[model samples]
Target: MSADKLYILDTNVLLHDPNCLYEFKEQDVAIPMTVLEELDSIKDRKQSVAQEARHVIRAIDNILSAATSPTQITKGVQILVPGTGDDSKLGKLSVFPDHELTSRQGFLPIEKNNDNRIINCALHLQSSDPHRDIILVTKDINMRLKAMGAGLQKVEDYRKDQLVSDVELLPSGHYHIEGNFWEKVSDVKSYQEGPNTYHKVSPDLLPEAYVNQYVFDDSNDFAARVESIDHEKTVLRDLGFGHLMQQSCWGISPINIYQAFAMQSVLDEDIDLCVLNGAAGSGKTLVALACALEMVIEEGRYNKIIVTRSTPPVAEDIGFLPGTEEEKMTPWLSSIHDNLEAMHENDDRPQSSVKYAIEKANIQFKSLNFIRGRSIQDAVVLIDEAQNLTPQQLKTILTRCGKGSKMICLGNLAQIDSNYLTPLTSGLTYIVERFKGFDGAANIHFEGIFRSRLAEYAEEHL
Candidate 1:
């Protein structure tokens, strides 16, 4: 089909995904001059988004370099599909110089505010080009509302990285059968392999099953992990429900069945990545920390435990803090300490035991800023508050994992703090959906709140 629409991207969209320019298929894309200026101002900051801003600038430059003259550049430049020749069908990319326009004409005034100028640019394009559809794409909700209010033809949130329409549709990492799970299975070949039991059933038995996903029944009689699936059959590794509930790590046991699944994944050496999603007080941090300690301190499977998380104010406030990087991060990582304290509360000397565990595990608290270029190996990396991260930021961290390393990502989608991220676009959700089919990864969305009655009540009502 011929390209009939023009997409004007905002600054936040580029920062959210640097490679979004190529996702529009055959639609023409444009960047307002104000958006470029915003990216220029933010490219030098210490925040993770600054790196993405620089990438977007470089991508735009690479595409515009194909143009021979300034007129052709401002008008449009062909965006060829990567690895394709010049004859390949492609879309056009251009820079809209909204700063040169003097006519406001019923649009938002081009004041000192950059958002107003960008909205006015889209409004101008809508009126100037009556033949094509003009759409304003932004991650900012207020900016979209202003563009629509300014009489623009169309305004939409940047959804190129959004995999699901609603957060409710996300996989909970486990499927619960209404009654006895075995009763639903008609054709099944059960066998034993070494110490593990495996069941080969028809694909129609669990059509929605994915590798590494857990399945159980309400009767509490059966629990199994999907090991492999193909056109012929689906293989399941039977996990006795009672045994899973009885599993303990670092003197900590699962409080609920969902946590049992999470503990199993986190403690398993075969799984390289484990993603834990839940509400506040759902014991995500506690379970992850406990398993990390078990693997690092008691079992000696890993050399150390590395804990890190992204804070909203980390860009500006982290540099001003006193002492070392660990001390500065202690405030944001206080939740980790809280979990440690809770785990050692019953000990004879709680404070001393917590300090000893910290020292014994060789735990290091690092900032996400310094984790870009280092290769992490022989350690258990725990990333808390992963929902606040963008997909680009998460990719940077995930790629740093070297051989003999495991990553545990913990996040509460409802508590995302980034202004540029929603539940559908959060890095946690992206990884869960992207890695669901991978055999070496496991995802668990915890159930219930175990912190306290007051906390549980607040989580539901307040």
Candidate 2:
């Protein structure tokens, strides 16, 4: 398979998440001796990955030990590096605020600072394996730059977070129609022509998306509709929920998949920007993704699926974060992956080889701090962590959208992670308020949390 799939491990990759090695199940995996040395140095450090790496290394060693003298270990990713080949020997080096490499830094009292030695290890490997895909993988960007400058192929940090937006992991965007969709309810109760039906809307009917447009069609459907769009900002008209199969992230939870079908019924350009707001675990991401999958690979409403999140990091976070951006983003990006796994589990049908059965191009996991001034088009953009965004930030993200693109911002306004900010002042709130009158926008909120009884109770009561 010319997948060009030779991989090298970096120290920070293991530290970020120990299970990262599992993501490449059957691929040829490599770990520079420097990375191993780095891991050895940190094995006793009090961090989650350090603990995990100890176990991981033990497990891998066991596998290596079990391998027969005759049988080829034809499968599974292995952590390996060159030893007899490189002319270099491990050197001890110490790094301090004032430690400059130009000063002939040595691994003196310190055996080897985690960064430089592993880098030297990577460089040595590159020197030995010149062309057979010798790549340096590290979470440290500067280290990556150093490796590249040293003439080694340094790649971006590939966290098991699987941050890449694959065809299957992409998210969908939606629009809401709340403000004028039902404002002056007239007895004019015809799908077409007002007040001319003469049959009169029964007291039982309320406004809703009937035949793909909002009208006082009936009331029984609004709760489900509101509930569906509330979390996913999509309509559920197909599952016999009420309306037709309107699109966007309406409902895809175990309780709401029916609503998702209905929302798919209403999927159309008329309602482009869909809002799926929910308390954590309500399956907002799942449903948004379902709709996005539908439009992208199934219905062709989009060319690609782009999922972006803006953590906004609150001008003042509680304290300093350890490690780097990858470390910082792990906690937040997990929400997206959690939703994706749920979607994949729910999706039992056969899928395409390249694209996720219903989705494609999850795209890049962008930090809200970046993405400014970059224009996005021809895709369904999902802005997660929207609660952290201010009205201005939200506006900026939305303006980055180009022709034929739709965006959905999903966040818990009440969960407002940003400092000194409230639900009413969140960027999501601003977007809802600003786009209230736009026919292309839809604002929906999901109140029920589908994660766990304890979590829901905690969110509700304590």
Candidate 3:
């Protein structure tokens, strides 16, 4: 098929996402010979990567090997399908002075992936034919920036799936609720009408977050349902949770420290909402469920605990995903099961009783689409993988909170699944940004991955 765009594949781009080959579609794209060479080196390995590395190299090799002549071989920056080639000659690769491509960032002695050859190739291509556009496709943000800074045209994230920059994304949150005050709000006059919980603000933080749809009683400090101001009981720094308030199920689980504790929040009378945001394996969902179970079995706070993830397979992407939504979500939601297993492990209840609790625990594995019409009052709603929810979608889910209900949105911002900034503009930010001023409202940011040293290291380095 013929196409308009010209794409030059970088080594990292292919390795980062193996499907990189088809992403260019009908566009004129060519994997750099050097990139192919790089893939060859990884063909024989024990790791999972060896299979992919070998597959990509073998596929390309077959396509190139059968060509009868150079004229029929893959040429031009424009992509040719596996067996197709363009007769139009683009001439041998143009050569440019080495200085045109080198970066001072290179002089710093970083290892190979951040090397110079990739950058040089793009500069040479661009400088040689000013009219012929050469796009350097890479996953490295720094490399792209360095390429641009060096005067060559460059682009980061060549995953053809990327949406427009203006596309709505999940909004990253800000920590604005950093003060100490306690009080209650009575009339709640339109204050706590929804089943969703609302944050009651301390006298100190009056009228901070009433942007729109936010009901605020600015004149009063000691209202109902909101916390009552306390003067006698001090900060209680001795509780040992100095980095956060209240204990977390995973990180910095100090019962006392009240600095930057993170948890999902919902309604108090109906079902208390405690949100947890931590890196993968940080026990955010596990902890949220533990709390939910506590309320269901012990506190009698709510009828059931419902857990959901804001993700389902998109159409084109689901081809590789086996089975139905249940099967697909099974792998992704393994974390949910793992946590539930942990919750029920060693319990005295019978298998049926435990299964009943788990089933009756009111845990509903749901997609973001169904949350619109349901008024979830008197229920603990835990939304996992919330980063996948866009801002508008998240707003819709949050607004569906019914009377005496709690909703918890949890996700790691850095590990977003959606093509858009589904980690930022989503409802998580909507709630965090909208509810900081209320005294009854509390939030925490759990630091340090509790899974393992390697998991934490992976998050930091990779």
Top-scoring candidate (TM-score): 1
Better of 1 and 2 by TM-score: 1
Write the residue-wise lDDT of candidate 2 on 219-294 in tens digits.
3343222222222123332223233333344234335533353244235565667767767777677777667766
Segments in model 2 whose C-alpha atoms lie over 4 Å from true places: 1-266, 312-331, 346-359
Q: What is the C-alpha lDDT of each candidate?
A: 0.91, 0.52, 0.51
Per-residue lDDT of candidate 1, residues 298-342 (tens digit): 899999999999898987788999999999889999999999999
Q: Say which prediction, candidate 2 or candidate 3, comes out ahead on TM-score.
A: 2
lDDT of 3 at 176: 27
Leading candidate by lDDT: 1
**lDDT at 387 for candidate 3?**
67
Q: How much does candidate 3 score in TM-score?
A: 0.45
Q: For residues 150-173, what per-residue lDDT tens digits would candidate 3 score against the true structure?
A: 677656565443333332332122
For model 3 the local lDDT of residue 121 reads 65
Looking at candidate 3, the ten consecutive residues that score lowest on lDDT are 232-241
